[model samples]
Structure formats: C-alpha cells, structure tokens
Target chain A: MIGRLNHVAIAVPDLDEGIRLYRDVLGAHVSEPQDEPDHGVRVVFVELPNTKIELLYPLGENSPIRSFLEKNTAGGIHHVCYEVEDILAARDRLIAQGARILGTGEPKNGAHGKPVLFLHPKDFNGTLVELEQI
Target chain B: MIGRLNHVAIAVPDLDEGIRLYRDVLGAHVSEPQDEPDHGVRVVFVELPNTKIELLYPLGENSPIRSFLEKNTAGGIHHVCYEVEDILAARDRLIAQGARILGTGEPKNGAHGKPVLFLHPKDFNGTLVELEQI
Candidate 1:
C-alpha cells in the first residue's frame, strides 16, 4: 500500500527556466541539476515543507519525456510518486490486483536513490503512478 | 509560497469504477461521492496517510473532465494542488513573477471549502497547478 506522497514531477522544456521559476519566483529551495542517464532525464528538485517538486527535461531524442514534450510542446505533469514501506510487497499486491507495471516489472533506482516502479497510466485513471520504497 | 501538497486530482471516466479500484483493490479509505456542481464534476476522496487522491468525473456535457476524457478515454491525472499559508499573498507573488492565474484571478471556494486559485499550465511546465489556502 502507498505510504505518503513523495513528490510530483513536472516535465519542462528548459531546466534552468524551471529552476528559476521555482526558486526565484516561488521561493522554493532547489537542488543542483543532475543527469539521470538511466531515466534519460536531467532533473532538479524543488524542496517544499511537506513534499518536493521534480523538474524533468529530456536527455536524449529517444527519451520518453521528449515524446511527451513533442505532443504537449510546453511540457506537463509527468507523474505522481507515492512512498511505500516495502517495494516488493507493494508490487505483488498491485500485480495481484491486475495493475501493469512498466519497465520489466522490476524496481529501478529512482531520483532519490531508492527503488521505484511505475504503474500503467490506464490502470491509474490516465495518470502515471510511481511507487517508491521509503 | 506553497505550504504543502494537499491532494492530487485525477480525472476519471467512471467515478464508481475509480472508487472501486482504489478502495477495493488498493485498499484505500474512500469518501462518499459528492457532486461539486460549481466545479462541474462529481468527486470522491481516497484518503492516504500523507495526502488525498481526488477522483473526478464529468457532471455534465460542458464539464471540463468530459473533454479530457474525450482525449484520454482511460482518464488521467488532472492537476496537482499545493497548500498556501495565505492565498492572496501567494497569488500576488506568483502573478508578480509572471505566472498567469486562471479564471477570474481571484480565489474561489475549492472542494474542501477553502479558497483556491489555479495557475496556467503553460507557466508551470504544462502542469496545471492549484493553490489552496490552508
């Protein structure tokens, strides 16, 4: 089962602009940009009191975010992450309930250096749901 | 400034089905369905330990969720809501920083009976951002 709301990710065309918007304008504490090659994204975290905002930009032409941006042009909310106490348990429970997991159906290292898995958007009402181990 | 993440809203084609998925399958506590005529949608809240998930369905032909579902038949994430300590101050700050407020540029009563304002998706990397006064 989901534990807590981890973070909401937003895909942006430009990482610096997104950082500036959240930092200077929104007064959020933003971390240095980091390249998540495995995920094929350049990301930065905007820290909030109770949660964080992840700014994601495509790292390559084949990156999924690139295709999302191609259709949206302006980028958009990529996914919502929820924390779980146990990754395998959560995955099994979801699978038994007939939820499809993305990417080999195994947990991968997420931005926070924790195990994470993405659920099919169709199963989650059109929104991609990310489950991360706490 | 944003205080905390209040909830994530997902637009669903069927409200009852969505409730079943979260409540029966995911084992979440779900609130009774409520018709929010002002927002032109019927909604239910899935209670989580840290935050809530709002399932939205079109209430009428002109409802915005109707168009969203037309594009994404399976439904999807609608918007992200963040709590603000002061709605007016947050609006003024965001507006001053070039973020366009949606609707009438004034706070309106939101689902939880709190003042809320929406920021343009274009300004926040295409993610519709909702600010609610807590």
Candidate 2:
C-alpha cells in the first residue's frame, strides 16, 4: 500500500512567483526547476524536514496543468503523492479493489526519477492521487 | 517555516464511503470518525508511515464542506496541512511576506490538538494551506 507522503504538488500560473513565495518568503530550500516533458510540467521541489512540496507549471499548450489553471485562475493544489514500496503490487491491489488508474495503466518516470502512476480523481474522492515507488 | 506535512484533507460526501475506499480498498489504517462541530465537519485520519490523510465530511447544512461537495459531487482534496515549529512566528513571517491568513489572524486549535492557521488560497497559488504548530 502507501508508504510515505512523498510530496504535495501545487500548480502555479507562474513558476517564478511560486518560487518566490516558497523561497524568498517562506524561506524554504528549493531545487532548480526542471522540465518534465512527459508530465507536461516544469517542476521544482521545496524540501522540508519530513516531506517535500512540488511547484508545478504548465510546460506545453496541451499540458493538463494548463487546463487546471484555466478552471482555477490562480492555479491550485494539483495532486498529493504517496510513496509505495512496490509499484506493481500496489497498482494490482488498487485495481482489484476497483480503483481506476490514469493513462496507460503502467508506471512512468516521475519527477523524482522513480516509477509512478496516477489514480483517477473520481476514485480518490476527487483528489488526484499519485503513487510513487520509493 | 514548514516542519512536516501534517495531513492532506479530503472532503467527502459520505464519510462511510470514504472510509471504505481508504480502509478496505487502499488497506490503510483509518481512525474512528469524529465530529468536529467547531469546524462543522466530521473527520477521520488515515495513518501512513510518513504522513496522515484526513477524510472530511459535512457535519451540518452550514458546513463549508457541504458547499465544496455541492460543486464536486464526488468529493475531493480540500487542503494540505504543514507543520510549523512556532505558530506565531510562522504567522508573523508569512504575513510580513504578504501572505494572508484565512479566517482570523490568530491560530485555532486544530485536529491534532495543535495551534493552526490557514493561508488564503490566492496567496499560495490556489492551494488552501494550513500551518499547524508542532
């Protein structure tokens, strides 16, 4: 099942603004922004003592974050990630229990360079949940 | 600023259904349901290795969660709570940095029996963030 709270992702309209809020204002250690073309996002990680916060911005026109931003003008909390020891086992268990996996039903390389899969928001009480292998 | 991820709150239409999904399906350890009249919401905690998941449901007609569910019939992620070392210090720092605290500027007793304050969604890139003093 789920292991740790890997990171909470917040989609921001402007990556620079998001960085300023967390870095300059909040005074948190933030990583360099990296383009995740596969996920259609530009991401930066704000490291914390026990968990991390991921700042996400749209990378391409068809980016899902862009659509989310359109619905929410200021952008918002996009997803919460939970770590799992075994990705396939967790996926199978969740599937057996009638949870819908997003995309191709296969794990992909996530922002942390680990295998990850996204569960449909409808199945998770309208919150997009990401399961990452750690 | 932020110490750890306290919990991710998800507003659900039905508390029982939410529990079933996380407990029975996800195989997570869930706490007993508790009605928080002060917040006008019923809450339950799903314990994980790293962080907890809070399942929230409207306790009364006037509950804010009720309004959220009206828009999202399927229920969804409500807010993310981050732990802080000192609530007052965190509040002062954030306020000085132009972050608006939700409700009153003062902190209130949170679910985990800690002083907590909520930041406006607009300031945090549309994420309703909760900062709890640990």
For lDDT, the strongest prediction is: 2
- Lowest-sum lDDT 10-residue window in model 2 chain A: A1-10
Q: Candidate 1 residues A1-134, lDDT tens each? A: 67677888888998889998888877778999999888889999888777788999999767878888888788888898988899999899999989899989989998789999999988888888899999
In candidate 1, stretches whose alpha carbon ends up further than 4 angstroms from where it belongs are none
User: What is chain B's TM-score across the candidates, in the order shown?
Assistant: 0.96, 0.95
- lDDT (Cα, tens digit) per residue for candidate 1, span B59-111: 97788778888988998888989888999999999988888999999999987
Task: Report the C-alpha displacement of residue A76, candidate 1, in angstroms.
Answer: 0.5
Give every collision pair in model 1. Answer: A125-B75, A125-B76, A126-B75, A126-B76
Reference-based lDDT, residue A95, model 1: 92
- What DockQ would you assign to candidate 1? 0.73
Runs of candidate 2 with Cα error greater than 4 angstroms are none
lDDT of 1: 0.87
